[model samples]
Target: MKKALRWISKNLIKIYAFLGFTYLFIPIIYTFVFSFNKYVRSNLVWKSFTLENWKNPCKPIDICSALGNSIKIGLLATAGATLLGTLIAFALARYAFKGRGFVNTLIFLPMATPELVLGASLLTMFLNLGFNPGFWTIVIAHVMFCISFVVVTVKARIASLDPRLEQAAMDLYANEHETFRRVTLPLVAPGIAGGALLAFSLSFDDFIITNFNSGTTMTFPLYVYTHEKGGLPAQANVIGFSMFFLALLIVIAGQIVGRKRKVSA
Candidate 1:
């Protein structure tokens, strides 16, 4: 009985982890498999295996356009959010200033707020400011929410860095600008990359907030949600699979680069 309990204790975590991954990946697996299915109108059921969907991902109406819009918004938002948030993170981490705590708290509030409320609030603000809801509005909203996440992520990375590195550079007669460019930026690059990736993912997948801010701009998630009434085409599944694989490839490439850098170092 004692051996049985010990074995169970040792294997329980592994079992749980396996289950967790399986649950998370089941939908993705289904989407990938169905991408190759030949369906007339809807991808509800797998009819037969065919490469047409993969060959022509733009076969579905507006799928390509929506995806393009999503990509555009995601890239723009990620760029803006990462730049702004990295500066804020650096300020909070490197310098002491009055009302710093208040600013930090304000940054945290955006992350803590519910998406629905945030969306509505943004909509109201845009209306009050006479800013029409459209592609730019969606981008603005994405940047607003994504900035908090970026700041949180980059701030943690900045905090984790050793101050001695900068001091050493200074001792060697390097100016503040040179030390930051040569020492600080390189060390914190991974964090910025991670934050940008996260921001892009969030912006790309956003439905609720985008729906609120986007007047007529159709993003990928909004397109998927709206087109579900007619059942999404197999090409939609193809797009999903493509995005999954693209993200996976990026992650794998990043890992490989990191490994190479470590080896060289």
Candidate 2:
């Protein structure tokens, strides 16, 4: 008993990590496994394995279109949120301006607020403004909530930046614009990229806000939710697994590129 207890104590952390990862990945593994299921209508039960689902991921009606809409909204929202948030982050980090504290507080409101409340409020605002709920509305709603996360991410990066680098550039006779373009932008690029990626993921995964604002237009999440009464199609699982793999590949590629840069530097 003593030997067993000691062994367990020594390996507790490893065991915990293994269990944690297993718990997190179980659903993802299930999704990947079910993607190969040969189901006529419902993918609830695994009948037989087949490659047809992956071969024709877009075979299901409107699934690909829904994915395309999500991609479009994610891109637009990420672009808008990253641009605005990066500027806000820089301003907050670099300058002391009137009402800066107020602005900073406001930035956190959307993030702190519940998605249901935020979505409903946005819906009300859009209706009051005589705007129709559709693709642009979804994009706008995503950007609004995603900005807080982007600002928080980029602002931390901006705060960590060494002012001495900028000072050194100035000492070397580099003008303000030139220094910013050459040195500051490069230093800040990683943070901006991280923020953009985060924003895109959040926008793509969003369902509540999209549902509240999207009247007729359908996104991937909405499609999945709407079809839940009917067993989820194998195509949905295929798309989900493909997206997961694509995201994993992107993260791996980014890590490789970052390591190369560090080694070269």
Candidate 3:
């Protein structure tokens, strides 16, 4: 008993990490496994395995349309948020302006506020402005929340940037625009990319805010939630798993590129 206790104590952190990873990945594993299940209506129970679901992920009713809407909104929101947030980050990092602290505090409000509250507030604001909820509304709502995260991410990167690099560029006869376009932008590109990716993911995965503003329009999350009683289609699982794998591949590729850059440098 004492030996077992001692061994467990020594290996506690490893055991905890293993369990944590297992818990996090269990849903992903379940989704992947169920993606291959042969089901006519409900995919709750495991049937014979088949690759048809993978072959036709869009076979399910309206799933593809919903996915397309999500993709469109994600892209638009990511673009808007990343552009605006990167500017804000640069401004906050580089300049001292009136009410800068107030602006900085406001940026965190959306992130700190609960989704339910934020969504409701947005809905109310839209209604007051005589605007109808739909695709644009969803995109607007997503961009609003996503901007906070993007700003936080890019700001951290800006804060970490070395001033000497820009100074050196200026010393070499590079003008402000030339230095920013050539050196500053490239140095900050990774953070901007990271922020854009994060914003896209958040917009895609969002349900509460989308639901509040979606009106008759449906997104993937909405479709999944609405179909929960009838059991989600195998195609849904296939699409879900495919997205997960795609994101995983992108991360792996990014890591490889980073390693190569490091070696070359």
Candidate 4:
């Protein structure tokens, strides 16, 4: 009876695991299906599949332009945020100074602020300064949020690292810059990269802040929101699936590279 009970427990656990996986992936599956549905109307009618959204030229070109702009903004914002974040992390993790706690809290204020609040504040500031809300303004707003994430991730990594490694390198006759270049940078690179990826994804996926500050610009998410009043779109489904697969591929590649480096070491 005990063995039977154990067997039942194992089977129930497997069933629950399968259910969780299905729950997680159902949206992806539905999104793919809806992308191919011939029924553009949101009616519950189940019907034949169509690929018109992907191949049709009559469809809005704003999506293509938005994709380009989003990638460009993601790159720029990621670079700006990562560089500033790295510096701030190094300062906080490696140095002691007056008002350290206050400074750290200030750095987090932007991150903790709600997106709507941040966007509204930025909009007000830009108007007050007579600055037109444009691509650069949007990028700056995004960087404000992205930098905090980078700082937290990198600071945690730096805190976990032993300082002795750099001291040992210095003792072996390496200059301060050389020691950092050879030892410290490489060691903290993963966290930096992970943070950069997070930054890029955040910039790419941003909608509320982008909408408030985009002015004449249109990002992918903004475009989606603007056009959503018509109905949930088939093209949107396609884009959603594509992004999911692309991000998944990049994550898998990063893991493989990290593992290879670990094995080589």
lDDT by residue (1-265, candidate 2, tens digit) is: 9999999999999999999999999999999999999997888987999999999999889999999999999999999999999989989988988998799789978888999999999999999999999999999999999999999999988889999999999999999999999999999889999999999999999999999999899999999999988878899999988998999999999999999999999
- For the record, the alpha-carbon RMSD of candidate 4 to the native fold, in angstroms, is 2.6
lDDT tens readout by residue for model 4, 1-265: 9999888797998888999999999989987777777764551355777778657622656777887889999999999999999999999999989999897998889888999999998999999999999899999999998999999999999988998999999999999899989999999998899899999999999999898999999888987787777665567777777888899998999899889989998
Answer with 1 or 2, whichever has the higher lDDT. Answer: 2
Worst 10 residues of 3 by lDDT: 52-61
Worst lDDT 10-window in candidate 4: 38-47
Instruction: Give candidate 4 regions above 4 Å deviation.
Output: 1-22, 41-46, 56-58
Clashing pairs in 2: none
- Higher-scoring candidate on TM-score, 1 or 3: 1
Which lDDT value does model 4 have at 20?
A: 100
Output the better candidate (3/4) by TM-score.
Answer: 3
TM-score of each: 0.94, 0.95, 0.92, 0.89
Assess candidate 4 and give its TM-score to the true structure: 0.89
Query: Could you give candidate 1's per-residue lDDT for residues 137-227 as a string of tens digits?
Result: 9999999999999998999999999999999999999999999999999999999998999999999999999999999999999999998
Each prediction's Cα RMSD? Answer: 2.0, 1.6, 2.1, 2.6
Residue 199 lDDT (model 3): 99
